[model samples]
Target: MSKAPNNQWWRGGVIYQIYPRSFADSNGDGVGDLPGITARLQHVADLGADALWLSPIFKSPMKDFGYDVSDYCDIDPMFGTLEDFRTLVQHAHALGLKVMIDQVLSHTSDQHPWFAQSRASRDNPRADWYVWADAKDDGNPPNNWLSVFGGSAWQWDTRRRQYYLHNFLSSQPDLNFHNPEVVRALLETVKFWLDLGVDGYRLDTAPFYFHDQQLRDNPGRGKATSGDAAFPDVNPYTWQRHIYDKERPENIGFLQQLRALVDQYPDTTMVGEIGTDDSIATMAEYTRGDDRLHMAYSFDLLGADWSSPFLHNLLQRFADKSRGGWPSWALSNHDVPRVGSRWGGPDCNPKLLRLAAVLQMTLRGSPCLYQGDELGLPEAEVAYEDLQDPYGITMWPEFKGRDGCRTPMPWDSTAVDLGFGNHSPKAWLPITGAYRKLAVNLQQRDPDSMLHFYRQLLHWRRSQPVLIKGEQSLLPVHPQVLAYVREHAGERVLCALNFSDRPATLNLPTGLQAAAVLDLPGLQGGRLQGGELAFEAFGGLLLSLA
Candidate 1:
């Protein structure tokens, strides 16, 4: 095993996300556990990713799966014990991989002991641990804010004769970050993991940490502009401009405090998940300096919209703005559909998956690769009865939810349970038939396969200093292709992608013209002709000038 890299290692590095419940199940419980992940550290290390970001294994009631925490310090029994987690971390470090765990700080399960004591009575010792307010005379919620899952964001708690605020399911209540003690306690949780030798944290719903303490109503976001049911026409939350609900200025102070703790540890970093609709702005704010998040990412790249112009505009915006901060890119995660399925149009070729990988690796940000993505795997098709995700069950038929993307990885197609090793005949979620056909064992023997392409491209990227730490300039945007230049100490690399299925030729920008086109998939070089380059269907080009 190689030695672990330094703290700045995450900058422009790749992090693989592991949804622990479905990563691997060593105990035959039909669910993945910490030991399962510990055994698989070699696979992750061999994937060429610099770090591993494990989703929550913390103690939870599973109301919202692991997002709703019951305890901040211990691992959930369903995942494994504390010793199992420590062993996993130790093994990951032994493999030269940094471990980053998910921290769901925005809210806690209604069953959490802290929330239990807080809601016992308004005057209890822990009464102010969560957000609780007096109900209006009409017995309605205290404010107009709505939960992201649906309905009013406030829950009526008869025990305290008050309405507690929740930005998600009623079973998951928002914590009062306004309480200084709550902040101190959460900081202690951060220290707990750091003391355990864990590398860092991925803060979930980071901007939602603080709410409008005055309980002020939010203004409307105006009329609907799209037909997507997720952003429904009748949803009042979308109707309002959520001024007081979240993104409070108070969050900066909290971030500074959090950063101070993180700074105290050597070679540690924090990446936040910002879910605001105006995600680019939020990402910029969260990662604006060394005092806040080391980096932040949003759903801008994870949504259904995929076009050359859209990506061009987004990259241009980031290049022009986002100074003093770093951006993180993720094509798919536990929450969204797999990129191969989402972006693989009817006219797109499977070979283009390698091109997509090249683009993700060469972009001006740290990249996050979801499990099984290297094999060009698509979203698994789960039947209605097989669905266990609350998000999918609540909005079934219209929005199938995230379970399709969270299906277990397929190591050996011929093995029972696709080599996941669950003793029971039925696994938690049914493995996708399409994924079985592209299992790892088959791809491992095929040199031209997407998995092999990822290996070659990642190895090449690791050797290129300019690609890893370079300044970006958004080149002139073309209709069917997006172009950009990454420069470091006078060394330049041009990254261009043909987002459309049809072949298109475009003129290269001035400073990018002299490149010897480096075919990332094959590592071969070609000269640019007539100041223009032609890209095949869904193809991408990374050109380097000698």
Candidate 2:
């Protein structure tokens, strides 16, 4: 059953994120494309997702896996033509799924025509299109900024005898948003997509749109930890305070401008990926007053912390600080390791993974589900030679980059490449042999499968309005047991989740009796008897109180 839309379809929406290169390859070529995604649109709708957010599909050099864009206004030939995208959008809309594409607006590939013109000479019409700066007297970069992928954020350009700032790869130069012309041109690109019938955009590295005009060096973090979702020990980029390189004051205005442009198109929205010093606070600020992004998400919950106390505190803190702004929560995405493997350990604990789906769906915000996660797929073991991620390549052995989580989806256990696609050699990334048990065809026949659990959970979530738009409050419970009450318009539901591997017990509050135990499919029932509640390991309970 497809979802029916409201004017504001994003509110409490379940967004399914698809990494195109790994989703499904249609025309072979060893890579997934728009047609492949179009063919699978029914799968998303059947999965009970309200919308689908696709990772970058624009023209790119693939340095950062489609993040470094060479052209914003056209679809990459590898992914098919603009007509293919239009067809995808039409198919998705027919399935009642709003189509949201990734907009990598902060930087462009070094081979971009704009960059080519900007670097031609000092007198070119677009000489100032990028952040070009004269080197210091010692021939060092203008500032001490660092790239999220690795070393210095600035790269020397031989043609102009100057350095250009690149927040990521040296081949991906940061656009000078300080220039009015740059902003205007980018808006035109956005308009092009909007005109083509795209519903929204997942703004990439949103705070990175603007930088410090003076090119000031960032300060050090003495005992402080990293904030850009990177562990300080793994990458030096997280060591600095990052007060000047990104999250500048100028970013808010640009966001407002972008929001205003999209506002012209009805029901069009944006969700920005925020990775600033204080991402939750930034999320609140960026989405506050509905004048900027319709909603925003941060990497705070994307970390390795899966404790009940951590989850409680993070949600509670965001609730306390957000004022009236809405926030989107995601446990997994194309950029991070799959939550099933990341949090569930080597076994990819099925019980815990199922409980997490319930918890994520019940949370008081829109939730995003990563592709392949509904099947309880673990992180694929990619050999060193198969690693294509530059980030993973630079940090090998210790960190495998994101290729493990970005493996192709498994469709049929009996089919070659697990039914991901037919390719000359293989899919973009190899599907883990272990995923054969979790393939869609196999899971479809198993009522207890993770795939069925996700579908049932999402369908049940849609019927519970309180969980959709409720005011959340933490319940005092065992540290390993996360409990919360969701209340809205005189209807209330108590949700309790056991996050451990063993059984747990909690006392029922005085004068409260569960009016009824809600039938949450695929979740083990927690019993309430003798003034106490008993829960199985990784069990979850949803009940109405009298």
Instruction: Say which candidate scores most in lDDT.
Output: 2
Write one digit per residue (lDDT tens) for candidate 1, span 110-202: 888999999999898889989999888898888889887778999888899899999988999999999999999999999999899878889
Q: Where does candidate 2 clash, by residue pair?
A: none
For every candidate, C-alpha RMSD to the true structure in Å: 3.1, 2.9
Candidate 1 wrongly placed segments (more than 4 Å): 1-6, 223-236, 345-348, 522-527
Q: Model 2 TM-score?
A: 0.96
TM-score (all chains, Cα) for each model: 0.95, 0.96
lDDT of 2 by residue, 1-546 (tens): 222232887888999999999888888878999999999888999999999999999899899889999999888898999999999999999989999999999999998999999998999889999999999999999989999888999999999999999998999999999999999999999999989998899999998988888888899876556644444357877778888988888999999899888888878889999998888888888988867888999988778788888888887778778887778889888777778777877876788888888888998888988998788888888999989999899877777788888988988899878877773347767767888888999999998788999999999899999998888888874677898889999888889898888888888777567888888888884877766778988887888977
**Maximum-TM-score candidate:** 2
Deviation (Å) of 451 in candidate 1:
1.2
